[model samples]
Target: MKSVTVKNLIDLFKLEVLIGNEHIGRVITRSRAHRPGLEFVGYFDFFPMERVQVLGKKEINYLHKLTEEERNHHIGNIVKYHPPCFVVAANQEGLKYLMKYCEQEGIPLLRTAEPTTEFINKLDMYLIQALAPEMAIHGVCVNVSGIGILLRGKSGIGKSETAHTLIHRGHRLVADDVVTLKKLGPNTLLGTHNESTREFLALRSIGLVNVVRLYGRKAFQEQSRIVLDIELTHWKDQALNNDLELEPKFSDYLDVRIPYIEIQLQPGRDVASLIEAAANNWYLKQQGYSAAEEFMKRLQNE
Candidate 1:
């Protein structure tokens, strides 16, 4: 966290300072950051919270009616609160006194041409996300067989449907559609569904449905380690480029490189069976056995 002075803020975002030149040295930063960006836009309304005030043309006009001493007391209370910043919208007429006070206190004064509502709305949106928890991308995630499986697809043939079938097979569901993946540490990547919309699947005929209730609670997982990655793609008659090694290669998603497989989907294909076999195949491979490779070797020997 850091703080920016009024002079710096005036330079950045190029906002005009209508009042308070003395307060140019005030600092601003993240909530806990001792040094804050005075120019920093926050998600919350820091002005009211810090006892800083907003003055538009209307407020300025009303303030003009107060006696000189009353206005001084009001302004004094504001300065005593030690608010780092003050924002004024379209009050150039009343800026002289405010600017003079700001200069003495070293407080930052900000003025914007944009309407008050628009300015606050835009600032809030920017600050909220900037301060929110940060997540890192790892790999796509899917839940299968009570285990979360990360699946990748070029665009869309049947990634969603494959997940649907896995759900119907009594396998618990974790995520659907776009999945957010994060790396927890070395060799461990976590995957989950979109925050706004997860545990839901979209079908061409039926549209969207809740996976948890329709399938069961066991089908939904809040988080899962991305242990395996299966890619669904259009089937090819004969791959011109096949790996001679007949061994699977790994790919990097985020920082983790995961063992991946490409499953080609075609009409009349039992995708569920293929996925299950793929998972089992991976399991067997980890156990130092290859059923498909062994079957090929036996046929060749015959």
Candidate 2:
């Protein structure tokens, strides 16, 4: 099963490890975090014990209000359920029973500098990516003129060449040669670089080029939500749509439908410029303006 370790969280977020050093290696199978508001009041119905537990000012203050016996009883209830860890957000200190009970029960306790909501949001984003279903495809993912575009084609095609042109034209490259895509939710697919070949892009003539070192940080982005997938096909194929308009095209990835298109590659056809135009047109359509639709309407009026 896909899982992330508690140690990974500590290293990823620079969390201060308080107790349960040996338990730091414990695995967290769930992607969401839980704030134990009801659990603190001795209600444990359907509580997700495997998720990371977060305690903030509201929860901490509530626990502090209870008497020693009442507090320990509630804390023991939470600890016995065996949560992955308890993170005290906003850099809180002096968590007496909460700290002691976790240590005694061998549950990992952690602290973070961010506020409750902020830390949870950041942590959840990472968790979703870490645990989400991921697959690597032989394609390039780029941010072309503010739109995320995935270029796909067979080997020796112009994918790399077109991506290099877009990057040289001040657009950002998310990943080259191979892009790892993660399904974030029902409608979101995030594209990112693989750890092995992150900062490099391949050019047939020059081999692998360090894009960031050569073009600086402005040439790369950590990730992008893929909005369009464009497949480059040979001109003579005639099997794909060449003049698709007046309606949208779509394809599925991990059961989620993404806008898809096909661009033909032939002599005298500037595939790079075509890609840029596609990206720009996609952005315009997103803003409720379709150049193709407007042209059709003009023809009807004429």
Candidate 3:
């Protein structure tokens, strides 16, 4: 449901607005662009009206080959469909008639200096980032050994405290209290700090601290790809007696399942070290080395 206006595109691309100043608010619901070559020849059966129509050199040349009446009729039908906007790439001239139609129909007409393919690629990338699905979660996200590790637990479970310690140990903190996660692709989730608390971290003893200033800019990251999830829980005597070796677990967020682990927080246990080790272990697992699996294989062979 995410959408961006033609004005947003203009601002992002710095395009020249040839017409339809009043209709720059047209919504662009799709990230893809259409050439409309067939539609230009008076075929509109499968025209994608929601996409931004991109008029390249070939389409413009084809329009020039037609007679005045033929050109207007075909172009008129295209405008009648109410496309989001028309972007004339390569800064191609001889678009006066098309601009006139856009002005008459109140459809925004934009011009870009870049070639058609390059402009389309840039616009698609921008739209994809702008329209990605996002959600905020109550947790701490940090870059541990180049792996984005998310710490989740109840209030006062030391999520922020562990993040603080990790930052001191040279790991970058992405978000402390609220982690905003965006799904960029089918299996990719990007994590970033909430704008309100981007460079700040909250702690019980010291009210609020600026991590960037305290630990330098290297101690913070604007965003990172989430790869692991670590949940903290209070220690129980019975739980400690369970199997020491466990299979890998996964947690789902935005339909992407991330490698997951649970650590027990106890009075004397070093939570920061445990989390750091967990991150390193996760990295090793990604590299195809699993200590637990190897040990299990050894037991089977014996």
lDDT for each of the candidates? Answer: 0.62, 0.89, 0.90
Q: Candidate 2, residues 1-302: lDDT per residue as tens digits?
A: 78999999999999998888889999998998999998887778889998999999999888878899999898888898889999999988778677799998889999998999999999998899899998889999999877888999998898988888888989998998889989989999989999788878999999999889989999998889999999998887645553537357898888779888888888999888888888888888878997767888999999
Winner of 2 and 3 under TM-score? 2
Q: Model 1, range 1-302, lDDT digits (tens) per residue?
A: 42344455455446775555555555544322111122222223343434234455555665577777766656655654567677776534556666666667767767877665565565444333333332533223555654457777765577777777887887755666667766545676667666766677776668888887787787677777777788877879886355434566676766687887777888898987877876776677778997667877998999
Question: How does candidate 1 score on lDDT?
Answer: 0.62
Among all windows of ten consecutive residues in candidate 1, which has the lowest summed lDDT?
A: 32-41
lDDT at 194, model 2: 91
How do all the candidates rank in terms of TM-score, highest first? 2, 3, 1
TM-score of every candidate: 0.50, 0.92, 0.86
User: What RMSD does model 3 have?
Assistant: 2.7
Model 2: pairs clashing at backbone N, Cα or C within 3 Å: none
Q: What is the lDDT of candidate 2?
A: 0.89
lDDT of 3 by residue, 33-120 (tens): 8999998777878889999999999999999999999999999999988999999999889888898899888999999999999999
Comparing 2 with 3 on lDDT, the higher-scoring candidate is 3
**Model 3 misplacement above 4 A:** 37-46, 61-70, 241-245, 296-302
